[model samples]
Target: MADWLSPAEWDALRLSLRVSFWATLVSLPFGLLVAHALARWRFPGHGLLNGLVHLPLVLPPVVTGYLLLLTFGRRGWVGQWLDQWFGIVFAFRWTGAVLAAAIMAFPLMVRAIRLSVEAVDPRLEQAAGTLGASGPWVWATVTLPLILPGVIAGAVLAFAKAMGEFGATITFVSNIPGQTQTLPSAIYSFLQVPGGEAPAARLVVISVVVAMSALVASEWLARRAMRRVQGR
Candidate 1:
């Protein structure tokens, strides 16, 4: 392992974790909102919103990345406004990497959350409302607890997806070593070089380990949450 990976490997590993965490955290609320909308609402644009949310699942990662660049690039519309107003730039920054990962992983998160939400008993919500709980209060106290397992599962899925994300991240953020070169991107770079094969292999192993650990943690959390909800 030492022969394969250098300090740069450690940096990439840490950055991947940071990016994945931020991506998952930032997207969770939105995922839950979308999941609730899909479960309980039937507005006119509902289908469109659902389709848009799942577009990343079917669209090529490169295409998604290009779209992000077009919309969030320095010269791009939203990108220009953000840069001018907030001094926030994502074109080639670590923030951009997080955005790309979040976008790509959003569908998985939404799907998991929506399934969980749909499985919830609306009758229980109605009872809570009848008992003087407001809609938001019922959701906060009742619905959320029931869906906690799914939320955890979705977050884990998103985190895993973010960790392995490469095409969208590279296109949106470009591959800047130590800044934006995540584990997958670093592996790609190593594979392109002659003596970099061993390092690439090491990174791949690390990625697998990280992904496995995340899965195990998520499963454990989901089970624990399920037990708690049941106990309640």
Candidate 2:
């Protein structure tokens, strides 16, 4: 393992983990909200909103990156305001890499959660409401419990996607070592250099292992949650 993974590879692995963890954590609540809305709501522009939420899945990563750059780059409207008002910057930074990854992975997360939410029996939610539970209480005690498995699956899917993200991250955040350089970016950089193929191969192995582990853990969590919901 030591021979396979050099110091740079190790750094890339750690950075990738950090980025994916943050991306998944930060996106979870938003994914849940969107999923709930799509699953239950019937308002004007609902179709439009649903389409927009899933557009990332259909769009090219490079196009998504370019759009993010246009909306959140240093000179762009939102980025400029964030820099000036909050002293926060995303362009070409590790945080920006996280944002890009989150955006790219969001559709997958939303789709999974939405499907789960839709699968939940609305009759149970109505029954909870009739039993004197408020809207928030019904959602908290009834809807959410039924969809726990989906939430876990979605979070893991987003995490894995973020771990392997490349085009959007690189286009939005550039490849700065020890900064925005993730595992995939590191691998790409290694492949571009002479005498770097072996290290790149090692990183690839690490990436695959990490991804597989995440998926297995997600499956386990999903099954556990499903069993609990069934017991309920």
Q: Local distance difference test, per candidate?
A: 0.94, 0.92
Clashing pairs in 2: none
Q: Highest lDDT: which candidate?
A: 1
Over the stretch 161-225, how does candidate 1's per-residue lDDT look in tens digits?
A: 99999989998899889999999999999999999988898899999998999999999999999
Badly placed stretches (over 4 Å) of model 1 are 1-4
| Each model's backbone clash number | 0, 0
Model 1: ten consecutive residues of lowest lDDT: 1-10
Model 2: residues with Cα > 4 Å off, grouped in runs: 1-4
Reference-based TM-score, model 1: 0.96
